[model samples]
Target: MRKFLCTCLLFLLLSVPLDAQELDIFGYFEPQFNLIYLDDNYYQLQSNKLRVDLKSNLGENLEFGANFDWIVYHGKREWNYWNFIPERVTSRYSSARMWRYRFTFDDRSFLDNAYLRFSFPSFDLMVGKQQISLGTGYAWNPTDIFNVKDLSDPTYEQPGHNAIRVDWPLRAGFSLLALYSPESDWESSGKLLRLKGRWQHFDFSITGTETEWGVTDYEYPFVNLFTSHKRRLLGGDFAGELLGLGVWGETAYNFVGDFEDFWELLIGGDYTFDSELYLMLEFYHHSLAKSDYRDYGLNDWLRFFYQEQKSLTRDQVYCLIQYPLTDLLKIGGSTLLSLSDGSIALVPTVLYSFHENIEFTLIGNINIGKEGKAYGSSQGHSLLLRSLVYF
Candidate 1:
C-alpha cells in the first residue's frame, strides 16, 4: 500500500478563492508503469489511480469528509501473487467489486475513506473507514499493526482501514488513543489502546491490542480459507534527538494461541551533513526466523506474508540517503541487507518536480546475494516510471 498525500492539499484549497462556507474539493491522479525482471522473465505492470476528496464544515464543531478512489489496473499476469496482495484486503462494509472479466483481474471502484468527526476542546470522535496509522520507524515498522506498510516506497499512497477511533489530549504533550476495527465477517475484530506523550525532547508511545486471526485450513486449502485463532500484541515506540542526531526505535511482541511468542525490534538513527545530504541507518532482529529458506516452507511463508509474522526474514539492516541536486530534481537510494544469509537489495531513484501540479519519478531495484537467501533468491532488477498530476 501507499502513504502519499497531504503535500499539496492545503495549497489546492487556499489557491482557489472560495466563499467562507463553500465546500473544498481537491484530489490527484497518477499513472504508474513498472517493468519487472525476475528469474529470466520479464513482465509489465500498469495502473491508473484517481482519488477525489471533499470536506465541508457542518458547523464550528462538526465536519463531514469523504474520499473515493477509482482505479483501473491491468498487468501481464494476475496479482494473485502472494507478495502483491495486502494482508487485510477485504472488509465487512466493502461491496464495490463488479464486472468480472478475467482478461486479468481488477476492481472498478474502491471506497477508501468516508468519515464524520465532531471535535471538542479536549477530544474528538471519528467513525467510518479511515486511517489509524501509528509508528516511528521509517523503512520498517514493528509497532504499526493497524495498517501493515510496504516500506519499499514509503511515500506512495496506500489504502486505509475501516475503523472507529477516539483521540483525547491530556497535557501539553500527552494524549490517549483508542481504536476498534472489525473483520469482514467478524473473524478478526480487535481493539487498540495507546498512551502517548513527550518528555523533554523525547516523544514516546505505549500500545496494547487484542485481536483474533482468520486462519486457513491446511487440510482443505482453498475450500476452507477461513478459521479462527486469537492473539495479543504489546508494543511501544519512541523517537527523539540524541546529541545532534535523529534517533528512533520500535518494538512489538506477539502472543499467538498456536505458536510460541515471537517479537521484533528496530533501532536506528539519522544524521544530516552539509545541509543537503541526509542519511539514515537501522538494524532489526526477528526472534522467530531461521537462517535456512527450506525451514520456512509454504505454510511458514504464508504466515509471514499475511503478517501473522512481522517480517519476511530475520536479522536485517537498512541504509537510505537522499540529496537534492537542484531546485526541481533529486536523487536517492536505499539498501537492505539480510544479515542471516548476507543477501541485499539496492534501489536507486531519481525524482523531478516539473511544476507545482505535476511530477515524474524513475527508480530501479537490484538484488544481490547467494541462492536460498531472502533478497538473493529473488535476485533480479526492475525499473519503474511514475507520473502524478494534481487537479
Candidate 2:
C-alpha cells in the first residue's frame, strides 16, 4: 500500500502543468495519531489521509473535474484488529499491530454534471449533480430524504449523491426549487423528488423519497414523505454579529407507511461577541412513533430498545464555544448532554494552519461516567491529533 501510494503521488507531480493557464491541481493530506489512557493502561492509534482534486475548462459553459482519496491506518501490534465491535470492548489490546487501506475515485464518473444556461430576463434552468442541504441541525433531516449519514460508528464516512435540480425566480421575493435523483448502485443510495418555494421571509418544502436497504440478504423497500417550514424571527438575519439575538426554527416529520414513523425538531441560534469569539445554543428532539421489529424478526421492540437505550428521554442538548487567536490558530469546544439519562460528554479541539495546503488538528473527547451510569463518573477519554497537506 505504501509503495502504491508513493507511485501515485509521483505520477500526479509529474503530470502538473508547466505553465500557469492550462489546468489546475489542488489537494490536501491529513495524518492523525490517537492515545487513550484507561485503567492504568495506554493504547495508541495512527491514521493517514490524502485527497486530490483536478479541474480544467472544456469550452463555453463546460468544465471537467476529478477527485480521489486515499486512507491508511496503523497501530500497536495485533492482527485482524480493524474489525471493530461495539460495546463489547472499550479499548484495544496493548500488543495489536494492524494495517488497513482504502481508496476512493470520483470523476463525477458515470454521468458528469454538464449544463447550459441562457440569460433571459429573470429565470434559468440547471441540469446536473448540484449540491443542496436542508434543515438547521448538526445532523437532522426529515426533508433531506436522500443520502443520510451512518453515524453509529466513527470509522464509516458517508458521501453525497448525484441529482438534477432546478431554480426559478419569480416576482418580488419569491422563488422555487425542484430536484430529483434517479436510483443508482451507489453507497448509501436513495431516490428523491422534491419541491420547495419561498415567499417573503418564510420558506416551505414538501418531498417524497424511495429507499432500499443497503444490507445484503435483508434488503427491503420503503417510502417516505417529508415537509418543513422555516422563518427568521426578531432580526434581519439569523447569523453574524448582530446584537446576539435571532431565532430560527424548523420541524420535520416522516411517514413510512406500515414500517415506522420518525420525526425531529430543531431550534437554535448563535451570538458573536466579536469577530473572534462566539457562543451557540441548540435544542433538538427526535422520536420514533413505532418500532419495526417484526420486519426483521425481532422478538420484542422494547427488549431491543432497553438493551440500546442510553438516554433518559428522546431529546438532546448541545452547547458550543469558539475562539480564534490568529488567522492560523483557533480553538473550539462543545458538550453533548442527554436530558433524559443525564449522561454528558465534552469535546475540545485545536487547529493550526501551517500553510495554504497543510494543516494539523488536535482533539480530545471525555466521557463523564460509566457506560450506562446515570451521572458523570465511570467515563473514558480519548485524544487524537491529525495533520494534512494538499497539492
* Stretches > 4 Å off in candidate 1: 1-21, 79-105, 183-188, 215-226, 306-308, 377-379
TM-score of every model versus the real structure: 0.84, 0.63
The residue-level lDDT of candidate 1 at 330 comes to 91
lDDT of 1 by residue, 133-252 (tens): 777888777777666555567656556776778999988889999988766444468788999999899999998887875554322433325566677889999999999999999998
Listed per model in order, the count of residue pairs whose N, CA or C atoms clash below 3 Å is: 4, 22
lDDT of 1: 0.72
Best by lDDT: 1
Position 154, candidate 1: lDDT: 64
Which candidate comes out best when scored by TM-score? 1
lDDT of 1 at 121: 89
